[model samples]
Every structure is written in structure tokens, then in C-alpha cells.
Target: MSAFEFVFTFYSLMLGLAAANVGTGFADMWRDRRAIQVGVCAPLLAAIVLVATMNLWLRFWRSWEGVEVGPWALITLVAYALPLVFLSRAMFPGAGSTTSLEDHFFQHRRVMLAALAATPGFSLIWYAAQGTLMPDWPNAWLAIRFFAPLALMALTGRTANRLGLALILVWMLVGLFR
Candidate 1:
């Protein structure tokens, strides 16, 4: 593969790793097995997803060359990241403990489903906004990415769920506007 392709693949994998980090919240959730599991897994999951995102960008980084400021990838990426921010907030339980886990979970379920549901729309926007040469790829990949959150929404509850929802909302919003 070309250098760009290599970098992209590596980053994509890293993104997957970071996405994997979300799983840690699950491990943390369990009362008995929570500590070890979450402690080990959460960071790992985040790492995976983070890596994946960066790699994905690397793969497409060239697309930025001579490109305008506002592309679908940029919008989608920002939108996607927003949910993670909120989810991190919901999960961490900092100043805003009032946002219950249950609420988060319910919201997560809705958002994830919405994101999956919204795929076509997001794809359309991505195509129109970005003037994409490879429109089909990103849209398809997004559907693939939806799996983790979908399962998490179904199985998880409490804080994890809420975080999941928040993340999904970000996903949805990004798709909608992009």
C-alpha cells in the first residue's frame, strides 16, 4: 500500500481501539467484577477508538489538500466527537451527578437507534456537502461503526447507557448536519 494508505489503516485500527474504550464503562458498571474489568478495559477501549479515528483521518488526510474548510468529514467528525464529550461527562459523574445513568442509557438507546436509522440521511448529506469522490465508502463504514453502540445500548444500563446515548446523539447530529 502507499504511505497514505498505510497511515490511514493504522489510524483506522486506532480508532477502533478507542471505540473499544467505551467498553470499559461496562466493566466498571458491574458491582463485583467492576473494578478490575473497568480499570483495565475502559482506557483500552478509548485507545482503540482514538486510534481508529486518527488512522481514518490519516487515510483521508490527503483529501484535505486543496479542499475547502467545510467538508462532510470535518462536520461529521466534529459532530461524532461531541457525543463522546457528553458521554464522558455522563460517565465520569463530575459536577453533574444529577444526570442519572438510567437516563443516559435510555438516551443512548434512542440516539444509537436514531443514528443507525439516520444513516441514509447522513450519507446523503455527506455526499452533497463534501462533493465526495468516494461517498459510498464512508457511509458504509459508518453503518459498520454503528454496531458497538447498538449492542451497548441493548445490553447496558445506568451510567454507561447514558454515555452511550450521548455518544450516539453526537453521531446522529454529525450525520444530520453533514
Candidate 2:
């Protein structure tokens, strides 16, 4: 098999497990729905993680197409997927526990956001290692597109509800335009 194929197989497995974790978490929450108090933030964050996982999976094909893969590439790929796994695991409450979604979200938001923030950095590293074609995009644009929402969420704390919604809206708008 080709290097890209072999390497991507490994990456895809990790991504698939991450996706499954999120899906299973949702199922578990539904199973325990009557025992838990549902809230806005945790569900929103779950949606975000689910979508981001899918995006990374889909984007991988286009982004890594025809790329050379080596040991360091494999290492970086594994590193990149680790955060997604962690974030997925964090999306739902633990077993046999009753808690409000908001409480769970607040408890884990920092780690979740940190995991979200790491994806772009890993993508950049992979691109740089492969010397792929992203030089035309400015650093400022990258930072604004990727980091702004995360930073706002990190800094604003509990007061970021409306702001988070606004940011999601803005991100959707940006995606539409792009």
C-alpha cells in the first residue's frame, strides 16, 4: 500500500473512534435523560465537537491528498487525533452519575476548548511538514477564523452564552461565504 494510504488508515481509525465516542456519549445521555437535567451549553458543545470531528475527517481527504507521509507525519497525525478523542470523551457525563449539563460543561469547557484550539495548530504543523499550499492565507486571517471564538469563550467565562451563540452564527456565515 502507498504511504499515504497506510498512514491515513491509522488516522482514520483514530478519527472513527473519536466520532464513535461522541455518538455513544449522546446515546448514553439519551438513555439517562430522565435522570439528568439538560441544558444549552453542553448540548451545544457536543454539537460543536461532533461537527468538528466530521469536518476534520472530511477535510483530511482534501487537505492531505497526494501528500507524502513519514514518521514525523504519523506522529503529528496521532497527536492531532488525541485531542479529539479527549474532547469526545469529555462531551458527556460519566457513568452512573446525575448532573446538569451546564455544570458538566462548565466543569470541562476549558479542556474542551483547549482540545478544539489544538486542531488548527496540528493542521498547520502537518501542512508545514508537507510543505503544502496554504501560504496565500495570512496568519491574521487564520488566527481570526480559528482562535477568536475559542479565546472569547475562554476569557468570557459564564457570561459568554450570547457571545458563543453569536460566534457560532458568525462562523456559519463565514463558512457560507467561504
lDDT of 2 at 154: 52
The C-alpha lDDT values of all candidates are: 0.44, 0.68
Q: Which 10-residue window in model 1 sums to the lowest lDDT? A: 32-41
What root-mean-square deviation over C-alphas does model 2 reach?
3.3
User: What value of lDDT does candidate 2 attain over all alpha carbons?
Assistant: 0.68
Candidate 1 structure lDDT: 0.44
Model 2 lowest lDDT segment of ten: 169-178
Q: Model 2 misses residue 43 by how many Å? A: 1.7
